[model samples]
Target: MSIKLDQVVKVFGTQRVLDDVSLTIAEGEFFVVLGPSGCGKSTLLRLISGLEPLDGGRILINGREVAASGLHLAPEQRGVGVVFQSYALWPHMTVAGNVAFPLETAGRSRSEVTRRTEECLATVELTRFADRKPADLSGGQRQRVALARCLAQGASTILMDEPLANLDPHLRGAMEEELSAFHKASAATTLFITHDQREAMALADRIAILWDGRLLQADAPEVIYRRPRNRHVAGFIGQGSIVTVRVTAAEAGTAHVRLGKAGQDVACVADTQPGTAALLLRPEDIEACGDEGAQLCGRVERSVYRGGFHEADVAVEGLDAPLMVRLAGRPAAGERIGLRLRSGWLLPA
Candidate 1:
């Protein structure tokens, strides 16, 4: 199912939780809405699910208007299933019973419900645990049960609200794989909501960054990370340093910019013109080099081991903030190092 939101608005008290948010999610696409806490991510989901009414604009599902002036479809009427962070499984029911609940409620025959429940359980590889109660399953297993129940609903679209937030680091990694497999097996259009950028990057066909009741940027994960539309989107999507640079020359999609008293060329949008502009230098863009061919030099102010590599803050002479770089080995504080500008993005003026 495809979802289209045109100038959707939702308010609470004096606050406009969602302000004129608009986007189109194609059918069978894994679309993710990412934002920080208290950023109306949940409210946006509720409005789409018909749990909350829109104050303005319209929402359509597969070309049919589900929400607009004076019209609101109930959750069940939307043909979308939801998997919440809590899993929301019935405590007293076994795995099979939970998966069978929706089918039974909709008046399917007993034999049909039983057969469908078994199919869903096998899809999630939980047929062995079909007789186990919710309390007897692990966190990941419980989450799978919720997914199986959603599958039983035969929903064309699925809405997930931070469904992996409650899992431990190790379990979260495992569930991510499972979720990807589940989506393929179900072939459902998924609208997943989460604050974790890492998770968003991993699972999304496209990602929408929602901040302060508005949609900032919506694009593929690589585009959002590499060429953010604005400073806010650049800062929010990944770790990087935004430094002021002088674009000495620019043509095509490359810009020759001066950074901290050194000149180097980097990638930029084609519209970029020669002048002063903000440059986004990711950790991978700055590399340690020998003094013979260094583009910039800095002092390592701090270094910390980040598992396989060390992340260091390099304080250049004229830049306001230190540039972060990944090092193969930890460097001593105040040590001088030569760096090469491998690549960077010039923010739109």
Candidate 2:
């Protein structure tokens, strides 16, 4: 089923939790709602599942109005199942029992329930643990049980709210891959929410970034990362060193930017506005220069080894902000060196 939010808004007391949000999630697509804490990402999910009422606007599924001015659908009627961060499984119920609960609630026959329960367990690769209670299972096992329960419910649309937050790094990565594969196999329309950029980039077919209860941008992961619409989106999507510079002059395909105290014009992509501009240059894009190189120069302030690469802190003149450049080889402190900025993005300072 396709999910669509049309000017959706949610309010509590006087606080607006979701602000004029509108999105369209295609059927069978894996969509991710990404944002920081208190950004209303969960609230948006609840609105879709009909667990919360919208203050205004409408919600449609497959072109039919599901939420509007005063009307709302119940959670079960929406054909949506949600897996929460806490795993929310019952300790008293066996794995098969928990998986069967949803079907039982819908009044399915005993034989049919048993068949579906087994199918769900097989989907999660937990068929052997079906008789075990939640208390006897590890965290990852319990999480799989939760996923199996949702599958047993026969929900065609899924809403996962920070589902992998409880797992360790290694397990989290494994679960992400599992979830991606499951989504492909089930062909369910999924809306997965998370604060982790890696998770968002990895699991999402398209990502919608939210901040302060507002929808900032929605696009494919690479597009959002490579060409952020504003300064905030650019800074939020990935790790980078930001610098303030002046757009001294701009021509056809490049801009001559002046880094204060650093001296001279550095050629960069002509995407900056006049006057003060903010340049976002990823550390990996910066290179150390030898005797014959670009005019950009810096004094290596410090360097730290980060397992794979060395992170160098360089101080360039004219610019008050420090630049963080990533180098393969470590350059010692106080070392005067020439630097070449390979690629960067520009925004209004």
Candidate 3:
């Protein structure tokens, strides 16, 4: 089932949390809501699930108005399954029982519930742990039990709220793969919320960013990474640096924005009107070069070892802030170097 929000608004006391937000999630699409704390990510999920009433605006699921005109459907009546951030599994019940509870609650036949439970457990590769209680299973296994319940319910629309926030790094990676596989196999329209940028990029077919109580941008992962719409978003989304400049030349959808007269310039993927703008340059966009052949030269202020690369902060002449460069091997402090900037994103300044 597809989900649509039109001019959605929510208020808490006097502050508006979700301000005129509207978005569409196509059926079977994996859409992720990306945001920081207090950005209303959780509130948006609740509003869609009918757990919280909206102060204004309308919501439609599968072409039916679910929340509007003083009418709202209960959470269960919305035909959507929610996987909470916490694994809401029963401690006394076994995995199979937890997975089958929803089916039983919906008054399905015994044979159908048993068959669906087995299938759902197998999909998460937890068939062997079906008899184990929540306390006896690992964190990942408990998460799978919660997911299996969602699957057994046969809800076409699913909402996940930071479901992997409690797992370790290794387990989180494993769960990400499982979630992706499940999405493809089930073809359920999913709306996932998270503050982790890496997770959003890994799981989303499209990502919608929320900040300061508004929907900032919604696009493909790579598009949002390569061409952010503003300085705030470019600075927030990735490990990058933002440099203020004036766009001097533009061609073929690329803008050559320069810092100042006799200062360095970098080409960015942008098509805005030429004026003051901010350029976003990721670590991969920069390369080390000889001082004479470079557009930006600087003295190494510091170098931090980051396993695969050294994050070097360079203090360049004429630039107000130090430029951050991720380079192979560590460079000693006080060493002079030049940087070759391959590309960046230009956001209107």
How many angstroms is residue 83 displaced in model 3 relative to the true structure, after the best TM-score fit?
0.7
Please list the C-alpha lDDT of all candidates, in the order they appear: 0.93, 0.84, 0.87
Give the worst 10-residue stretch by lDDT in candidate 2.
Answer: 260-269
**Model 1, TM vs. native:** 0.98
* Tens-place lDDT digits, model 2, residues 1-349: 9999989999999999999999899999999999999999999999999899899999987777879998898888788889999989988999999999999999999999999999988888899998999999987888888888888888988889899998889898888888987887778899998999999999999999999899988999998887677777888998777788777776664666777544344444555556777777777667877747756778888889988888888888876666787778888899887787776666533
Write down the lDDT that model 2 would get. Answer: 0.84
TM-score of each: 0.98, 0.92, 0.95
Task: Give each model's clash number.
Answer: 0, 6, 0
lDDT of 3 at 180: 96
What TM-score does candidate 3 get on C-alpha atoms?
Answer: 0.95
> Candidate 1, residues 111-138: lDDT per residue as tens digits?
9999999999999999999999999999
Pairs clashing within candidate 2: 260-318, 260-319, 261-317, 261-318, 262-317, 262-318
Which of 1 and 3 is the better model by lDDT? Answer: 1
